[model samples]
Target: MRKSKSFSARTLDANALKSFAHPLRLRIYELLDERGPATATGLAALLGENTGATSYHLRELARHGMIEVAAGMGRGKEKYWRVVPGGFTYGDAPPDAEAASALEVLLDDLVRQRGSELARWREGASRAPAEWVEASGFGRRSLRLTVEETAELRDQVLEVLERYRTVADGRQAEAAEEGRDPSTGHVVIHFDVLPLGAVPEDEAAGQEADPAGQEAGPA
Candidate 1:
């Protein structure tokens, strides 16, 4: 397990990012980061992939230092892997066409995964504990701001998250040392600020206009 800290992050080189851009590899990394240590067989079972295939990818991840052997788990032919403690940040998309393509693939996979997780959560909401059912939520709001203000807001949010992270890490460390489990609940936060430029009146009208051949019909 990773040691407790305020927050840690690293930027991946283009090659490292490219290596991590694979769909299965991304999923594997997510699993390790979220669920802690697990053997290749364990991950394979969860992902519905063959153990051999998973093992191969795990080795690839290890080569890139995205994951490492869980030393607490006894060493043998079987190996348990855990994510390196930190987050990944990319200042800008890679300039290389191939790297850019890989980035697109990774982003698409992430969007799909987020949708899947939400669907799974919704389906199981009724069965979830009362506290979780009541606590979990979703919301959206549109804000008008200059680019400078937007950047400042993002930095503020990151600062707040890092503060809370320090507390969480301390608690986790204490629990592990005491030979007890930490919180079982996991929180997923999705944050984004998309700027949709002004649309022309003609374009707006065209979008609202029905197709010439289509007749209006309603229930």
Candidate 2:
């Protein structure tokens, strides 16, 4: 949320995609994004990995510009790393077979991670504060829309999120200058929008026959 002039949006090329596709590297990036700057030793402890491995992956991520040394945060001879401020996307499908495989791995891992996070939240929700428990949950809706309409809806949602991000940044800066509140805590927001139930005919044919003997098609 802390926008800086140094931050720039990135679309991962094949090389960068391959570099970032490793499970450990992806997890390390997530940790940095969620928990702020950390040292290799600290990350290793959390990840149950050796410092050597974490250090190597950290360097790899840095090489791809996914992360950087957190300024003024580490003592001499030690370094802290954090995710770069701007976000990144996978971009178009990679032509290289290896890179394409890496992209699949990355996407699968991300979907699994999201499910795990939601499950964790549900398990702990009962023990959380009453207000938070009341305020937090998931919602889903099936909507009919054209491609352009779907894109417009996605953009509007992103704009709203950006507004909140700016507000959060301002509050964080104020807290840093003054004093932090004990009641403040981190919140993770997830947003996803995509066409549903659109399967290729060949893929659908390969699936088991429906009970009603109907062909599978778009919902």
Candidate 3:
């Protein structure tokens, strides 16, 4: 299993990857992760989709072990579904050609969605709560490190995030038991680490020519 800050997820095999590569299925999974448990009807309304379609996709997701029935939500004939605790991942590489192509499409869609969310947030950030505006924003850094060092840095960051995740889970449970809203905002955390390829010789020479460094571009 591959472990991230918030959860542990097993890498997906070819069959499971193929099953989960649909756009609607991906959106459904994202909703469950972000909004917590919900019924097919609820999800349908949120997505502007018909209940029948949502129900079918939900079942397919569940069949692939992507989601399951929420424990105590919904009544007879209405079932609530949720993302399975500890999600699944697309492994670094899929051996099957078809699966690899599917993974590419899935990843492209995910990146597009994330870009949209960030763009939306930026457009409305000024009107959001002052505290939220102050606390939320993007961050990035470029570092020179060996492969082992990169792995260590990732593990350390995950450890710190895991601690806060535990606290957040406890607080959520307490709020549920008390039958009161937590008044907590849902926050999304995005983390990524990747190698920047070696600079081209011409670019390297250009950089050396300007010792003062070029201004960074917008993120």
How much is the lDDT of residue 174 in candidate 1?
A: 52
| lDDT values for all models | 0.72, 0.77, 0.76
lDDT of 2 by residue, 52-168 (tens): 999999999999999998766668989989777546777666899999998887877767777878988989998999988887879888998888888777777767776776666
lDDT of 3 by residue, 50-125 (tens): 9999999999999888888865566787898876654456767687999988887777776776787888898989
RMSD of each: 6.6, 6.1, 6.4
- In model 2, the clashing pairs are none
1 versus 2: better TM-score goes to: 2
lDDT of 1 by residue, 3-50 (tens): 113336566667877898887898899898677678999999999999
What's the residue-level lDDT of 23 in candidate 2?
82
Q: Pick the TM-score winner.
A: 2
Worst 10 residues of 1 by lDDT: 1-10
* Candidate 3 lDDT for residue 175: 42
Q: Estimate each model's TM-score.
A: 0.78, 0.80, 0.78
